[model samples]
Target: MALKQYMKTLSCPPGCNLLLDTSRFDNANSKLVDVLVNLKRIGQVSVPNTDENYAKIRQIIGNTINDPSVNKDLIIAAIMKTDAIRKRRGNSARNRSGLGDVFGGMDTGMDYGMDYEQYSKEKVTNKDFQANFTVDIEKEEKIFGDKSFGETLKDAEKLGAANNDITSIFPTAKTEEKSFEESCPKTDIHCAYVAYMENYANSLLNFKDFTQFDGKWMIARDKIAAALLHLKSSYKGKEVMQPNLDNFKNVCRKFVFLCGTKANRERSELVKSAIFIASEARADKDDLEIHLTDLFGEVKASPTISKDAAVQNRMLGADYADSVRITGSWRSLGIPSRVNGAESAIDYIREDNDVHSMHAAWHQINNQREPRDRKRERFFYFHNHMLLRIATERASNGLPAVQPMSNDVLHMEFSTEYNIRPENDPEGILDDYNSPPKTCRLTRNTQETLRNELRDLVRYKGLGMERFGHHCEQNYHADLHNLLMKDCDVGMLGYFAVSARPPIFYRIHSEINRVWHDFYSNQRYRRQDIYPPYGLTIRGITLHSRCGRVNQAETFWEKLGTHYKLNHQNFIFRIRLYNWRRLREKVIVRIFMGPQNARLENYFEMDRFVHQLDGNRLSEIRRYDKDSSFVFVKDQNDCGWPYHLMLPKGGDKRPIKYRLLVFVNDVHDQRVNVGTHPSLNNPMCGSNRQNMQNAGLELVDDRRDYGFPTNRRWTFNPVPIVNNRDRYFGYMSSIVNIVHTGEETDFCNQAYFR
Candidate 1:
């Protein structure tokens, strides 16, 4: 009876003329199409316009004339079977719950309103509920020869009610070819590229906002294929490959813009990850291009060096026919040279070797002149080269080289310009002040000015704070607030505080860290704080989790989701401080976290607080929690980028060991009037700084540089640890392990009950 009911469900509903008298329609193909169209309209069959079956059915019905042998009933049965198979496939794959199970893999359970206790108590037994119904097409045609469609449908319903199984009529379900790539036949690279784009578009079907761009992607894919086909005729060797590859990259970059911008951060991050994967695919093609280029020589004959022109100008000091002989040359090497190197007339005098030297050599080879300001040029050059090296390395390693939509070639503007009105558009959507600046070629003089500005940024007291200071810090409170809150371009890295969104942020920091590493490796050997002059000491350090004490070999669960992550456990620090000062005095509680074996660059800023004390107290206890001055954890309202990364990934085998350092600074001497903005006072660190700033909220919590307590140059005499243990930068250390989340041994779980 159930099988008959399933078969009845596949057929058209009442008031269908095709079911009344099929003999009137001589063509079986036409009759089948009529039934299919009715079935499609009523939601029985879900055939999207893009489906090959939909097209095939349309073609057969529109073109077929008198096909005597073809059975329309069999075709209908096949369609029904295909639809069921697809439904089953999708149901099995879909993840209904964020917990990873769709429906607990059962027909009925607690999720579907069944009482868990009663259902569990009942004996689980397999019931033989199978049924089979047979359809007699000849008998049906004869019986309903002259019946009306409504009468025929009623008879079929009655037949369905009478039968138990309908295996003979429905046919077996089989895997249908639903993908466009399968239908299109990808025989070559062009077809493969087109298929890749189509697959990407198909993957975004779940996302409704991207629907408008789906058709555009198909059009672009076809356009790319056409362009490649046309170029194949005229271009020779690898030359043709270059243009097509570039075109594909351009298309990918164009699509990437749909993701980036001051758009919603959560959605944007998802789009970005997808675009990054697509861009990486294109970058892989670049490697193929390189291989092909190596296989084939240049498209044109190579040029030879000329000897006759400058033969008479052998003397270095003597003037030649071309008197000024200023043989000047200029070249562009992407933003690297344009921003901080020779193309921009900015140069750096190498202090110690880093990634920048490679770029300096590149500039020299290109015959570009260096900037006049030595110290300023060196700072810009080092940082510029450092960032450039990161991008180049990512490219070489087959990763996305820049932000998802960083291509300069394909730029688009809304037909109606978006205006950021502070009154109505508080998020600054129009001006996109949170976004990186869109700049054209900078003049040589402007480049020099930018260089000087960059130099000014890095010269700030602390290495880690240099970039933050120039962009958001150091500025007067009013000016900094304006820069952070307003819908202007001044908030971008080269210009503002919105550095974290772009990939260059990490690279620039890596360079800054490299500088610190060099300073520590060569200049300073001992990494402990030594202060014999001041009567202050780090009594002891303790790491506290929600449970009690954090020990080595602990495991913690990293909260993972489709678009977000959070560490299951949060920790607090308990620091014991001893003040040797007999009179009233204040000290800065500087805290940091680092790899047990690495340099200070890898160190994360934990917290910084100013502590005041009266006449000689031997010891003072200070407890720190997530509410402290430096911790930034993700929440429903705030978008903290990489805040989840603050907690290191845990291993199943052994607990992750980390070093905790606590050092103190005298409030009197260490005080620097780091100019402030509301951004300088927020505890949560994330990419949505501009979002908060535009809303006129604080972005960062601390007043000094981002890495305040340990940010300054560590030149103080080393402090001896009471026990034999590792030390760095004059800070007392404790080795602790972050336990895995939701573990049975973890006492933190008991908090839920309490």
Candidate 2:
């Protein structure tokens, strides 16, 4: 019956405008072959005249169409039977090189010489057939004009059938392979450097010869200079390297001493050579130099660690040292960061290294200034939030909560004069020996500089409230945090993995948050402007779990490691928006969450983005927790905040009370395109970077800052403003509570939340 349904969908041929009648063809094996011949006559299928191809086709039909266990095989045979009628009519010169030639002379190892009787009698497993037919179905469908045929052939080949000759019946276009040099853009020094390092790291000469140099820094330096000179001469006129050129050079200088005693130094030199060549060839020297200074000046000032154990103990836990070493080596290849066809710029940022040298290198190389900076700030906030939440959960679990390292402990008083303050100094001794040298004891001049930046960030009112001044203030605070910590070592509060695991990172971010609150506290918003435009009203917001509506949810830790898990129940927010204007309109929906009865400034942004409403009607919007804009759905090795950590870990003794706020505002400029990737259209992970870069060609996903209402402080009480005034914002006060479930509970199945 499934085969019949599949056959019914097959078109007769181009211009025929008719689907095949499955009723006309019987289910008999010979009848199926007759159908294939008829299909070939009508130009649908393309079966090679070779005996081996015919035998494989007959075996596939005999094995699948008659067997109940192999429905997929039947579909394949049915598609091929119908496809031959359409494909054979147009091309008389179909390639007849058999299956070997179709698979680019690769041996399929199928016994095409087997007789039909023996082949039919022997049971062909799907796994065995798939192993032999390894052609990509999508690629095959483009060539054969039948997706089912491609799928079936792939399946049949996997089954223990002599189906290797199937491809010879329908030839596919060959895709051109791109070389590393050709693939890397001339102006992207980062791309070239990564590519060069990948090659150097994997090469035999680098491991055998370069490792022999050991502590011979002088000999290695000369060899590095020679390599750089060669690289410069080779691509002198066509390449431009910037951003991470200094990092590349620094890695070279540190070499076997800092990075490793093996070939890592040589590898670094090779990468530097590529970047230098690219920069000298086409880059503006002055601009490149300026960017290097602005971005990587800290890398130069920070001293390299002589011991891997020290780095592991200081930045990450000593237990993670092995994992870090393994992961770092894997990350250094930069294979994960390489852009694929469907990946946008934001996608690259999400997948870039979270730890190791590559983390900083990734940002420098993929130089999309606005998106990079915006993502950087968002990442900082999100990461810190994760740390704080996890710490809360740990404290609930009877584990000690991570404490924030204070700046005062380091004698970093803003009024102090520049002086050398050592760790063991009696007057100003520092306790955290693990902190980066610069951060442990700041000179008086450095203290003054940091103080000035913080003061400016706190006092600044921004351009104006009318033009996203709140966002400007928020970004300014984040940027100041980066500026303050620029001189810190790369692994210590500079990169994600290391920073997230440290107490000092929280201290720095807490300071930024303090400034952000100060900036927003001084700003005023007109009640009229805060109100939703175009007569749109958010009717109400409700929370629901898998079982039913719920007022509370539970969170627990997964069985292993620091990973926490939300109760299995999938939580969703159902929002109803009424459009009183009586015309279709776009509106932005901003969601914020905070501790119940807490000050408005304590709220944390949950999700914010533009959503459209039906004209003259109420539109119902359902948002799932997994689809939060701040998290990424699991995709390969992509580095994102885990989805399970979306909710805060509740208290063990009592449930943690929280408020859910939803705000709706009318979109004035419809012309501003906020689009997402065609493949991954979810607004959950934020905007697509490529779309933002090519606004003319593709639409951006979202234009709002990472945090909306929560990005700024509120002078007036929002609950009253939303509820009492009948404004566009819908306030669900004290709607949700998070309880800490000490045991491993699968909430999705057990209905514990309900």
Candidate 3:
């Protein structure tokens, strides 16, 4: 109460006083307590000033102050109950009770109703969470680093002139003497880079705000804290240490904890790390400068050099005149597929006189190639290359580089205005990705599966296949190739191209890889809250789609409908959209379940877009307006651009990592039976087995019927421990060469994930 009284009695600043107006003072009850708490936090220990602050509060509470020592709890509670003091203060509009933080705006009291108890139960430990961030004590030792030892001695000389304490931490330095300017940091980036890394450093104290220590977010914070503490302790215990270094390390650690606990030391240390490079340059008498490089032009023929070698090459200077390079020779990092695929692709593309191959590397190299084909490989190459690039970029940004020391090759393929934005299309309706930023590798089985589905559609219905410019009886087929997929030795866990076009549906691959960089990174090292970070095994992808325009030249409504059945029980939350030309202008989103190709499905939800013929106010659209969006329609639009969004996980979910498309119209089951043989037009055709009947398509004995690869853990030998101690970062159960000894042991960092 006295704190509030002191605050009000003190005159506020002339202007910029937003809280004390008429409307504000009317709601003063909410403001008094908040103001009192803030004032006590900055300074002013006792209610002792009159003309200054706390003058009135002293007079009012003088009697109480003289009696005895008062605790903060009584003071805070008494202040909040002060009605007379409350009316003097103002400003009330809070977002919600429990939502806002109570002290210093740190949300410790309440959060978004997260199940803390459940989260804590699920936490694994520090060793399991090691894959999350790099926490090395040697790295954090930089906290004690400040000015050169020589500069510190000069500052000591200046301080030595004054009366100094005989018994100090740096007694030897005090005796030796130093100057002020000399003691100050010189060529020391510690202070200069503190603010740069503060936000990241503070994230380590995430526990102060969030009650729930979800393993990933928690370990990432604790390991950093551990690293900082180790640095601090080392600095303090140095018997012959500089006092300046100890103070610097302490302050640096404090500021870091103030920001957020979820930041990594690698990012925080980068600026200082660069400064070290600059220091090295000064020592070497080289150019005292560093320049960030920009990348452009085709990258498939990228100049061959390691990352470090690339940096050195830049330092030495090289003219990449008339050259094309792909940023990296490989898409993946250390995984099996990455290593294998990189080697395979390199050999294929490196063949001499493959000049035309540079333009489109993925399609022609992976599958069939024909210049006259309608669904041209070049078109597919450009589109898929775009997907590959985008996915790779996202992956590169989020996760650390596995091939940190390797040089990336230049990309040979190029796309004009490389984007899939709907505005640039000749047809307002979208099409398959011609050039995506990144591409995913598919299994031979998945590729063949799609082919069979398309073949069956072409053979039985004939109509849907006809629209795609393909025929079965006469033998002419659309120049068909597997959709946007790159071949790799280290393949993906699962990648499905869910186009409503032919048998281009299910894609279940083996290995740890992804098209979108986001998932690609996820497959490697994601901060998954439940399991320890290691490997991701994708089961399969259910590709569903629907043609929105409904302008298919060959519409076989009946037989096509029967062929679209999915026996997989995970089918729900299906929606389809169609742009009815005859209908008045309207934006609509429809939801449906059951068969993906059901003819008589109910339109769950739709909203008319145009109130008047056109209005400026209605031009802008929010994400909630699902009608105009490319999703909710059968599409070749199964590409993840600017962002890789997770398929619907119902309400609260870890995102359906795989994609699923729900389509309408008949792109399947030909009415006439055509013999499965080499026809006049159909030169490259294969029939798959019929037992694996998905929809009405007759599967051919092609390459798409293989099981996905698994990381065999049973081959590892048992980690025998005579003393019943569990090792950190241990993999006992089902390890390839490691045997399991089920043991009960206590763990310190058990709350984090490995």
Model 2 collision count: 33
Question: How do all models score by TM-score?
Answer: 0.31, 0.47, 0.20
Worst 10 residues of 1 by lDDT: 295-304
lDDT of 1 by residue, 94-206 (tens): 12221112211222211211222323342221122010011232223222224554564454343232232322111111221223233222322223333343344445444
Give the alpha carbon lDDT tens digit for every residue of 1-754 in model 3. 5453443433331121111122332234234444542334423455321233432442344234222233222232224233123322332112232221322233333322122232234212222210111111111221122444355445433333222331221122224333312332211222222332344444544433221112233244333333332222221221111112232332333232322232433333222222222222121112212111100011122112234433443455632221122122222111111112222232211111121122222211112221133232223223332323323222322432122100121122211112223332323222423433333344456456545644454334423322322232112111122222233211110111112111111121100011111111223211121121122111111222121211100101011111110011111122222222222232211111111221111111111111111222122222222332212111111111111111111111111111121111111132212122211011111111111121244322211101100101112221221111223212111100110111111221211111
lDDT (Cα) of model 1: 0.32
Ranking by lDDT: 2, 1, 3
TM-score of 1: 0.31
Q: Backbone clashes per model, in order?
A: 30, 33, 118
Please write out the lDDT profile of model 2 over residues 1-754, one tens digit for every residue. Answer: 3334334344321112101112222243234445554434323445555445544544444333323333332243333433343234442122333232232232334222222233234322121121011122222232332245456456323321223232221111122133323322211223333334344344424433332212232233333333442222122221111112232332222221222223343354333433332333222222233122122222222111124434554465444222222211112211221222222112112221222122233222222222433544443344344444444444334445333323344354321111212311222222222344423455566556555544554444464332233343234433333443543432333222223233344455555445444545665555554667656666777667643446666654332221112333458888876766765766666676666665554555666555655675777888877666545433211223445556666654256666777766655575433322221232322233433333333334345444455555555566675343544444433367666555444443333333
Clash count (model 1, backbone only)? 30
Task: Tell me the whole-model lDDT of each prediction, alpha carbons only.
Answer: 0.32, 0.39, 0.23
For model 3, the superposed segments whose C-alpha errors exceed 4 Å read: 1-55, 59-77, 80-85, 88-305, 308-581, 585-754
Task: Tell me which of candidates 1 and 2 scores higher on TM-score.
Answer: 2
Cα deviation of 704, candidate 3, in Å: 28
**Cα RMSD for candidates in order:** 24.9, 20.7, 28.8
Model 3 residue 630 lDDT score: 17
Query: Model 3 scores what on Cα lDDT?
Result: 0.23
lDDT of 1 at 252: 32
